[model samples]
Target: MLPPRTYVFFGLNAVRILGIISMLLVFASSIFVLVHDVQAVNRFMAEASESDMQDCDYIPGSTVPNQPAGVFWAVVNRLLIIFQVIILILSEVGWPLAFFDRFFPVLGSAFGLGALGIFQALIGAAILSHHVDDFTLVTAFFLFAIGCLNMLLGLIFREGAKARRSITNWRAQAKSVLPSAEDFRPAFVRPNSSFVPSMFKSGAGEERAEKSGFGFGRQGEKAAGLKGFLISKPLESLPRYAPPPRSEGSRSNSPEPQFKSSKYAI
Candidate 1:
């Protein structure tokens, strides 16, 4: 069976999803209302009689009335435009803020939604009073739906803190059971040490090189050659290659002495 925390997490997610869906529907419906309003206004202007046109307030290049009722529809259009802008800003800003501070976004969205509900209620009342048309009544209904969904989502966000905490604890426990990076290393293998070349000399040879001022035979020769090349000097100008000087007691001309064991002499 799934854990309680898992259920809670999913429930919260579902609420948030519903909230998003409702808001999107509201946005689409509002756009439809705006378009319908524009078409209605144009139709009214086209069908208006010559006497009615004179009674209507004149807008440049159009005979649409601007005085009493025209101004009201114009105001509604502006309000819908502002509402769209607010919805866009809230969605863009509030969602990311929710990731950091959950409570604030929840409260803010709730407040905004409540305000939308009130606005829609007023529009619905206007429609009932014959101040606005049936299209606005439909828009009002969409706004009310969006407002309810947003409020429900806000309530879920506010109450889901305990669920969030449980989920976080579950994650930490899961992490504890997993292997760490260090555990991935091979247990039987040792780390490699810095490399020492096979040609490296020790003891007497090392001391001899140190005493001669050159670090090593091959390295000194190579360094000198490279230095000559870098300085633009000809190969002939380089020092003549000479054998390393031998100690007086250990001359190369002396043959190594051989020892004879008496028991093996036969």
Candidate 2:
């Protein structure tokens, strides 16, 4: 895919084209109203001079307030357009000098374009509202539509720019957070035998001593010898006492005495 800057470049040009068209419409509508009003004033003067009724006073401002406002906005719009055009020409021509980085310095920006779009839209709406029944209505309507489209494009570009900036900032933060290969190294932990309980380790040491035919010390050798001696002895060697048998004919009517034996006694 193409880069975002390329898209923005094309989009800005589109806005400029639409803006130029809207400006032309504004000029046409404003000129039509001014010319019509001027003609009306001339007719009224002629009628008045030709012995017309004194009550036939023609007031120019009484027609509609939108005519004057439309003219005012048209003038302002021309100036703004001229300013942007000059900046664009200067930036482009001085590109090799690196004097300016952007094509349309201020109005080329997202917020600036949005503001311009809003201004044009307001002007178009005002003019269209007053010229509803006149031929100028068509031009005013077109101007209004173009202005709204420009506004939408401006807002979309602005959001795109914001997203790009946010992504750039996030990437910068992530890069700062990541550790460098030079500064990062993996460490492996080794278990210390000193921290282990002797009871759990003694069995392994005893087994090793028996296999090697050598003990860890005198205590280990004695423990090994004792364990070997016990394993070699027979179970019959332990003495067990026998209880006397009772006969059914002996009617003593007495309970047998209970005896508790120790663990080793059995």
Candidate 3:
């Protein structure tokens, strides 16, 4: 998870500052290399052999190895600067333009810095391989260092931005899923209508009665007297259980008691 807004603001400002510094470095180095390449090209053209000219008639010949690579990097650096400035400006300005970051983070500082880092590394490697002058050597070293820094910053920024987006998306989803005030309205009330049903009138009267107290007002009196108006009626009683009458055939099936007569028996 990313830190809170207070830290995020500071973090973004720091990233922007670092990005600007990287852009400046790239611009200055690219300009230096480009100027040097141009001068070298002029010198090469001036001292070129007739056979060298014949071999390459379209473009000027250069004795410098990987001369094209220098010019190519110069162009690439210029483009990188342009994009970096745009990303930084858009990020700082906020709101409408900030939407650019929201919609396309790939075009944002994270991706821009990452691309610049990768490009700088490539340029440093090219400089190391092709030419080794004191100025170029120092430039390459700085570029390599700056490139690594940019890459690290890019990664941190990307993860932070991802977390931020996720938080926003979560809040939006939660808001959408939650029940609104309209959802809690009484069942008798229609969603599209302003009219409340008469069923709620009794409830409103009860509320008023409670506020005024039982004997304070006519409404309170009515509320209190409602129970008196409701009379209690006695419930009908259930029948008691009884045995069924015996049939003659059933009586005949039963054995009779035998009586013995004794003298003076009553």
Per-residue accuracy of model 3 over 163-236 as CA lDDT, tens digit each: 34333444664578564444666555666654554433444665755553555567655665775753344685
Ranking of candidates on TM-score, top first: 1, 3, 2
TM-score of 1: 0.39
Model 1, residue 179: C-alpha shift (Å): 19
Instruction: Please list the residue runs of candidate 3 whose C-alpha ends up more than 4 Å from where it truly belongs after superposition.
Output: 1-16, 51-104, 109-129, 132-140, 153-158, 161-266
Clashes of each: 0, 0, 0
Superposed model 2: Cα runs more than 4 Å off: 1-8, 48-110, 132-135, 159-266
Candidate 1 stretches with Cα past 4 Å from truth are: 50-143, 149-266
Model 1 lDDT per residue over 8-126, tens place: 66665554445444445545545654555567667766877767666656432322246668747654754664475455445423545454245444334333333333343343343
| The 10-residue segment with the lowest total lDDT in model 3 | 57-66
| Predictions: Cα RMSD each | 16.1, 22.0, 14.6
Clashes of 3: 0
Q: Which clashing pairs does model 1 show?
A: none
TM per candidate comes to 0.39, 0.38, 0.38
Q: Candidate 2: worst 10 consecutive residues by lDDT?
A: 183-192
